[model samples]
Target: MATLAPQAPWAMRLVTDRRPIGPPSYAAVTLDASTQRARYTDTAGQVVKMGEHGTNQTNPTTSMSGGGDGAEPQPQTADDSTPDYSSD
Candidate 1:
């Protein structure tokens, strides 16, 4: 008489569909530098505009200090600089 063997593990398979959904739609926006404003447009060429720099027009300057350690010294001679050589 023959003996029965153990069954192998089962695995799931993926399914795919191929079809065209509908007409393609496009969305875009434009930035106007003359007025410093932004304009948005939809697929049908309808534009929605917005303005910027309402109150805070100028950018603030930020100061960054050196590390607590003292500044490094500058070299004087060409020998102190990096050595350069021609490679043929």
Candidate 2:
């Protein structure tokens, strides 16, 4: 299963036929980005095309927040392989 877009609530699935053969479990079908066409795989392992398809255009923000003074201190790992002999 794949999302129509980033953080989209609607999910889609790949199918050979677009027509409703039985009960449809998917909300929509996968589409080609460039041609804006509906795409699916046939029984012969070839891609099948259908009517034009479109989806909501979303510009996902890739920016991440930088570490600042308000940020919590990261945990420090201590090596325990060496045995303490000072108490001997």
- Highest lDDT among the candidates is held by which one? 1
Question: What is the per-residue lDDT of model 2 for residues 12-38, given as tens digits with 9 covering 90 to 100?
Answer: 443347676784333455677999966
Among all candidates shown, the one with the greatest TM-score: 1
lDDT of each: 0.53, 0.51
For model 1, what is the C-alpha lDDT against the true structure? 0.53
Lowest lDDT sum, 10 consecutive residues, model 2, at: 79-88
- lDDT by residue for model 1 (9-46), tens: 44423434578688434377777789876657777777
Backbone clashes in model 2, listed as residue pairs: none
Model 1, stretches more than 4 Å misplaced? Answer: 1-26, 49-88
Backbone clash count, each prediction separately: 0, 0
lDDT of 1 at 12: 25
